[model samples]
Target: MMKKYTIENNYIKLVTIDYGAAIHQLITKDKNGNDVNVVISFEDLESYKHNPTYLGASVGRFAGRINKDGYTINGKHYSVYTKNDVHLHGGKEGFSFKTWKMESISEGENPSIKFSYSSNDMEEGYPGNLQVSVTYTIVENQLSIVFDATTDQDTIVNLTNHNYYNLSGEGSILDHELLINAESILTKDSDAIPTGKYTSVANTYFDFREKREIGSTYEFKGIDDTYVLKENNPLATIYSKKTGIEMVVTSNQPGVVIYTPETMDENKISNKPLGKYPSICFETEKFSDGPNQKDFPSTLLKKGDIYKNETYLTFNIK
Candidate 1:
């Protein structure tokens, strides 16, 4: 059995497991003071092992795809695993599939847990002996996830948490309202790889400069795009009418990848039988294919440099 841990405060409760350092549950109070499990989760570790949708796990060594199935580091070409002709979310064996060491667990004003992992040089077709640590902390009504990493050799890295959230806790998120603080999104090819260009969200379905229902426009089947963040401010906000729960997302990352799955059935998440648009993923990280796109912010980490990122998800009642 996989070891699990829990940390709580007056307003929130969080449970996490060592396997993939995945979040098992995040409990928060609703408008009527009822506990709501705002994050999509599984019943067991086995279910997480077979997870294809990356439900609630920390994803890395690169959070998004590396276009053309490979990338170059310091004048050397490196080929990585690809699906549908592009590298997707690290590779076949990503951090989301590995067990991380529980460095520490504590409860106090800031209840928190830290998980650490080391990636060997050339593992998953990437260079550098990279060491990464993810710390999840809860204080008051906020859950903060901090990712820190250092590599022994120059390499590319982008990390983000893959958390599917449904503020209502028990239904589809199609009716939820969303507000993103971005003015543009990375242009993409037919395969969902960034095309080294971007388009303004103004006058487009991509626009979310103001609050709007996720289902307001049916122009696209579902969102799976990265919005270039305008600043290091609160990047997005989500609220649910059924539960009267609100979420404010703040991150220092340059891009936020928003994905609302077209469908969520039993097969997609193992034994978990879920309906269509069950939840939405708000992945804060560097742009997709950032290493290959000269025009985008670089995700390169040097031998001695530290890569640090922080994202905060604060909960409240609308």
Candidate 2:
């Protein structure tokens, strides 16, 4: 069973559920004054229980992959759950797969909903009694997400929301135009884990410094890369020519992972399979494998210290 909490303003209507604290609906009007749900979601809670795609769920402990040999804290190496070698999005049973407690819900002005969860030490091979909270606040045409956490012991933390967005509310995102305030993207191995190196997007398909259709260069290859953000303005902007709706994304995090799965398997969890390139995820967070990379932004959380991150998704008509 799923419990839903909702908050809306004249410009948007947001509905989120306790299961995975997943966003069930985000109603916003297109340029033509037609309402559309801009995020991908399942109609039933059971689909979320078996969600193959993260959808609009909050991921945690560590937002991206951790190399084969996890990380060391105070010279003590710790092992984490891994697929073949990489430790992915926390683990098999990550935070997105669990139910969160409703901490509070407010329905005026800046309407919002807060959800909390506690992770036990060694759960999924992470070391810490972690307390996590996520707040979703909706205003006129913006949705702000605040992620906060604290641990009882030294641990690594990097949380991010995985929202698959389609500004037009339908069809392949390939038709959308995008702009990323990023000069380069992390170079990755075949497995999609950064190799601690970066490549400039100056003349490559990775470049999004100027607004362009997503299918212009990378076409069928799609993308699953982390971009090193430029100076502190909105990190990225995406627009749909069809609906004339635009989304400006800003975050305090240093990197943003953009992904579009290579294939869309409708047989995974739903009878209706989302076609290829259905949506794209803009995951803002610390650099991937941050705990292991000394040069990347640190993901360390000391005992008694607080961890906080915020991302703003503002909508507009263009």
* Model 1 bad stretches (over 4 Å): 217-220, 266-275
Candidate 1, residues 187-289, lDDT tens digits: the string is: 9998889999888989886787888887787564678999999965789999999889999999989999999887665443422445567889999999888
Evaluated at residue 117, the lDDT of candidate 2 is 94
- lDDT of candidate 2 over 144-215, digit per residue (tens): 999999999999999999988888776678889999999999988877788889999897878899989988
Best by lDDT: 1
lDDT accuracy of residue 77 in candidate 2: 91
Candidate 1 at residue 270, lDDT?
29
Q: Model 2 scores what on Cα lDDT? A: 0.86
Task: Candidate 2: list runs displaced more than 4 Å.
Answer: 217-220, 265-275
Error of 2 at 301 (Å): 0.6
Query: Listing every candidate in turn, what is its Cα RMSD in Å to the true structure after a full C-alpha superposition?
Result: 1.8, 1.8
